[model samples]
Target chain A: MIILSPLGWLGRSTLYFLAATGRITLFALQAFSHIFRPPWYPRELFNALMQIGWLSLPVVGMTALFTGGALALQIYSGGSRFNAEAVVPQIVAIGMVRELGPVMAGLMIAARVTSSIAAEIATMKVTEQIDALVTLSTDPMKYLVAPRVLAALLTVPVLVGVGDIIGIAGGYTVAVQSLGFNPAAYLQNTVDFLEPLDIISSLAKGAAFGVIAAMMGCYFGMASGRGAMGVGRATKDSVETAAVLILAANFALTGVFFSL
Target chain B: MIRMENVTKSFGQKHVLRGLDLEIPRGTSMVIIGGSGTGKSVALKCVLGLIQPDSGKILVDGKDARGGDRDAFLARFGMLFQGGALFDSLPVWQNVAFRLLRGRLKRPQAEAREIAVDKLRRVGLTPDVADLLPAELSGGMQKRVGLARAIAADPEIIFFDEPTTGLDPIMSGVINDLIREIVVEMGATAMTITHDMTSVRAIADNVAMLHDGVIQWTGPVADMDASGDPYLEQFIHGRAEGPIEAVR
Candidate 1:
């Protein structure tokens, strides 16, 4: 009888919304639960590795190299006001490994892998392949998400390591040829500034970034709506979420490593 | 054997399935016929556990289909999707043997490939086609490959969702014949959804017409001719002016 009142109606609507959200959260939890079960797909993991790791190297490498070169030039010009141009190589090396390398690698991967995974899985969901997998005694999360997550965790660090090397090489190239720094001295300064902590932090960031990228892709993909527009929306949402989460994760990791 | 008792499914304010009930006997082929959006596909998906009904009980071999060990239950079934749903990144053989090569039922690569090739051959495809990607195959060939993959594990039950949707008439006929032959040879319980009367005639032992989320008529394939229900009559005769309206 109280349903007649305006406050009661608003309360009812709020409760309904909460119930809907609870159902969605339960759905997402069920998906995550499948990650630890048996029937792990090694072949799918291999395929994901090929897709997420090996193929991603060139693009991530290219992006890092360009950013590193630009960073080196900027640092050289900025340091000139204090007659401190010699600081260019060290600052560029630290900047690449500490920030630009991982962030850029993460963003590039979010752009590349998230859209592809989301679109592919969304199409599969739409076309009933996910259903087919379910009817075949297979859990789609285990068969789909786990393998990609594993590959991303194992491979993105390797991608970041490669990116780090390329970026430093980029900085060195510009410092030696364009900034009038000697090759031996630039390499020495880079080596001196890059402590093991920097390397470990960079790798840790890579692993976190990888999980964020792949999770967003799988999450949005499995939850996509119907039709072409639905798939397109899922793809866009996956990329955007992956990118934002990567930067956020990078910030947290950085804070943990240095700020505290 | 499969049975759906008082299945009711609704999305928001729209009712898709309303108090529907159906039964399928073991080792028989049942073709469900209806217009596009009449919930035939939804009914199939519900049986397969891909969609959950608001109220219903689906049983397989007298056991609840929604019970525990769902993986074991699903393992006995295979499905051929409407669009083939082939993995583009993998070769044809790998796609066929996807189930066999993954999970607890995994086979060695060599054995998986061999089985894939054998299944392909069973569907009237050659071994040379195994290495090619799905994108390289024609639509009919892709359907054949999908058929091969469906039967790869020699499942006891199979479901086909518009298996001949995109192919030419000749290709459709070939797929229809292949499905009929495979179902008969394996003695597998089969369920197929299609609006194509030719397919129903060619592949069905029994025909069930779904309209307004309920079975309007169901009988032996021969009895479908004399069903006499105006909806069935119009549907089978492909008439324009009947109870059933075109989407337009």
Candidate 2:
């Protein structure tokens, strides 16, 4: 094999990155295009919703609750240094709604749903089930990718909304039970401080992250090479790509929503 | 009828098919025989539109196979994969009726199930196995299910990819006979790619040998034994020494 110089290696890496990006963008566009087409399968969409949204509640909920509880304690201690421990409710609500809730939910989904989707599709490919689908005159994009992507796009934002509520409740429970904060006052403070934009931004982040997670899975899956090793690599790569893209998407969505 | 002219395909630098030409007439069974990795499957996939040729013309019934309404084109054909590629998620009957239960051929749920059971019966599967998933079936059983699925849509053409690859000797013979009977009964154009010489003899109306990315020999199955093409003779008689290279 010819050894590449540093510049050559860098150039090769750049080309690979661009090619991967182009493939993902096109796959996402095709998936979205099939969403509005006729001959839609409601059973598939519902199954996807159940798998991606409802089944994900336990993990996303537990993450939010624990994070919210921990945040309450940390902020209280940090605020005590300034004699402002009473700011716990407002800070916790804003924190979960503005950033932590959506980001954490997205990451959890990237890990769970993305890996699952990639492995399933890649395995189907290895067994030639995808080709069987084509032979049966069914479009794999519409049957596989479209339902999952559309379901994630619609349901993830709702999961974010649920996560936000659960997270705030966790903060409330910890404050009222352990920190001696008045329950009614804490609730009122949380409600008063959280603007609609905070919720909107959180949901928007969820939608963007959902699309990234799903599209990454489909792209890596369809682009998988061959064999058992290929399926494993596709699963690993999909989760990595989904997680990284979810975080990057979170940052961009945050900028769009919160930066002034 | 299906015809291919000057078909060429390569993945990166490794060329597979090179200026290959083939013609398959209507209502005949064509089996392409080649050594492992000799692009026999690739050739079948190219005609099935599962893969595109780098440069070629593939015509079916006087129309170009590619760049058409894909669903309409695909609906006219059925394929049984090498590994039996049954959907692990669906029961045996559902897998058999996969093409009929959805898409433009959507049948009512009960009607689809009935058709699936009927196909399963035709494939010699018992009614008890209809609700069992593919993982629950034996390899021979899975192949039968796959064969059932291949005939489900009753398409004008059928492609079988290595249909006897993983079966036992007796099972392979059984499957070979079943395939022969099905082709005879359906009167559908059939294309099969395999390395098994017994399978070649059993299911082929016509035989073609692919070596070095081109058709080395083509003739009626009876003529295959005495075609006098060295490549064909070496391959059919199972000689260690041959014109075709055994390894890359």
Candidate 3:
């Protein structure tokens, strides 16, 4: 329902946003608490691990490889403008391990896993499976949400590490094969340029982004309305929300790790 | 026994359940009948603690039904959902054995599967069907599987929501007969909500007619035809010219 006055409209919109934030925060807290409690379902957790982690590797790997190749080319050309083409290995290595690697992996999973989780859960709600779960003495948060969120939190960081290596390899292949760079020199420069902190921060961002993605999916799914349209809306909204949150989280994570 | 007193629930401006009261005796089958959107499901959900009425005192066996350990409270009840609501990812046996395989009621895997198979046979399903997913079964088979799951735990109280909503006439009759046999044989307390008169006749020991968010009429099923309440008559006869407007 809309109000006639602009002030009223603004107030209503603000209140709605605040209420939504409160609900999402409450759901996230409930999931966190349930995860620590007993009556755990190891089977559901293993299923989630395979779905969210192992199944996501191919897409994450391909995206990182192409991105790494493109980034190497762009950095080489840009550096040549300043007579600094020799900086290709250093810049590509740092750019990938520091930023692009985790962000890309997170965004990719957010698109794939988040949307699928949301749609499936929303459909279950529509079909009364969630209520059925409740009636069967099973909590939806424990059976459905905890496993998924925990699996994502554990797996996305590993995916990010794999993506980082593949991406760097792609850059190395491109540089040594086509850019007229020494294969040994390129590998040496890349090896010498990376530090442990860079990789650690990348994975830290991965973990944070993973939590955002899976949590958003479960929240939107559980809160979905009725009917087919409702399930569709939840799916669409989950991806959009997860993508936005991942980017915002990436920015905050970067500031925390590299601001100094 | 289940007793609901002065239950009132509202969603926005629409009052789905307004000051509704009902009493169902133990080991008796009570079926609530109403037109669509007349709060039948809402009332049932309230009793299950699936929906909380804005104000009400629901007593299950003389104890207040609200404010207790939810899992412990829910353990006493089983429900057959309108759409079957079986987990697509789970095999039929696992779905039926869900309660037995986990939580406070956990049974050994082999024992649980044995129970699930027995229940499936009781519902006219062959053991061969137990390994199939819900999606693999026909609608009637799915409904049978759901019924088996509902009674698998031997719950003292069972609820059926629109048990025959989307089935062919013969299948519906089969389900109705099966439900009647289960309730009579087990002597379990049963509450069902349905507009299907065939289902009502086959399943109800007592009948309650809901209209305008209240029980317009209620009595033993044998007296339903001569109840003399206009609302009940209008609904049972499916008359569009009665007090209820065709347009909401």
Candidate 4:
């Protein structure tokens, strides 16, 4: 019985995971289809864009800046052991543009936007506002989820581009001022090392991560149970799920873009 | 008119509605009164298509409620939710005019706002309260705003869920009177779910007592006290010892 119990528990867990994945995939497909349909709420879309994109700038900027600086310092120290300290500029540029910038921005958004979206929508569900929308002849999927997912999809790429520039600037500051590297030579090395494909992959990853973050928030919210505990759980699960999915997606996207 | 025939719904092991049957006539108010957790709200939600029944037929105006253009079907009805359910982000007027400002009922912003103010006035709110968010309003006022929003589009049918659940007796009386007056004036068919006998007395043209997932007693409001069903009698007198078991 004990050995069979372990198998039972594993099977139950696996089924639960599969069911949740199916629900989220269906929700994402519905929201994406609604984006192409008419009767779109421009006002709601604009509000979402401002909240997810413009409001997220400061945190995303700070994360990328610090991560860029620390990446430079770590690479320089490791390179010094091999007498390869001069490779810092190229490595920092490639690292920030290809990987760190988008992932960091996505994680920051997963923390900020995903939690907020989940809490707000879950509260609405608990209060019966979602039902009210349906009674008013508005499709909650189109009215609520589509606007948010679309906003995140459109703006996260822009945020990634901004983050990449800011991150390179952070590395430049650390290398030139503290590490005694020449300013013009460092800039030239950094610029020369970054290819257009690196920037495109970063922004592409940003868009994918954004969709995952917002979709997780909406899915958990609509599926929330009944009260304060339900809202809290939805918000917590949304951020955790979004962060993990963002990391996993970053790996897959990187493999697709850069793998030999 | 709305009718539910043998509707059944279960959430996991707990069956909320079991073969529930009901009928409400057009241009009349039907109040369904029951103890908490006896599936009154579930029945109401089923009629509105918010919660689908497991096995049953729901008819609105002799047409199957489940088969039709959902939006067109929904467009004929208005609902005032228990907690008001006003959008926290929108101002009072925008919330009131939500239907008029969007979808197939779209109107110019100015015209929608004017109609919103008119509906607000009908619900005893002033135009000055139009710009305030729902969170800024008191609970009773929020209920009034919800009522205003419900009738904003002049829907043919209106449903009120727990219209006086959380209010002082005076406020409850006022809301009940308003509900009764609005139904009469609008000449709209109304269905209300509540446990408050006072609300039932004030708002019902016909009353149905729901217990054990079925209608226990149903008759005109005047015949209620004399109908003499044990469940209805116990519920009306507020006695705990009866066919209905108190959860606690």
RMSD of 3: 1.6
- Segments of candidate 3 deviating more than 4 angstroms: A1-4
Ranking by DockQ: 4, 3, 2, 1
DockQ of each: 0.63, 0.85, 0.87, 0.94
- Candidate 1 accuracy as TM-score: 0.90
Better of 2 and 4 by lDDT: 4
Query: How many pairs of residues in model 1 come into backbone collision?
Result: 0
What is residue B239's positional error in candidate 4, in angstroms? Answer: 0.5
- Report chain B TM per candidate: 0.98, 0.98, 0.98, 0.99
Best by TM-score: 4
Decreasing TM-score order of the candidates: 4, 3, 2, 1
* Model 2, docking class: high
List lDDT for all candidates, in order: 0.89, 0.91, 0.94, 0.94
Worst 10 residues of 2 chain B by lDDT: B239-248
Stretches of candidate 2 off by over 4 Å are A1-4
The candidate 4 chain A region of ten consecutive residues with least summed lDDT is: A251-260
Instruction: Report the TM-score of candidate 1, chain A only.
Output: 0.89
lDDT of 2 by residue, B98-163 (tens): 888888888998888898888888888898999999999899999999999999888889899999
lDDT of 2 by residue, A1-260 (tens): 25758779899999999998988888888999999896677888998999999999999999999999999999999999999999999999999998999999999999989999999999999989998988898888998899999999998999999999999999999999999999999999999998888888989888988888888888788878799999999999999989988888888888888674
What is residue A108's positional error in candidate 3, in angstroms? 0.4
Checking candidate 3 for backbone clashes, the offending pairs are none
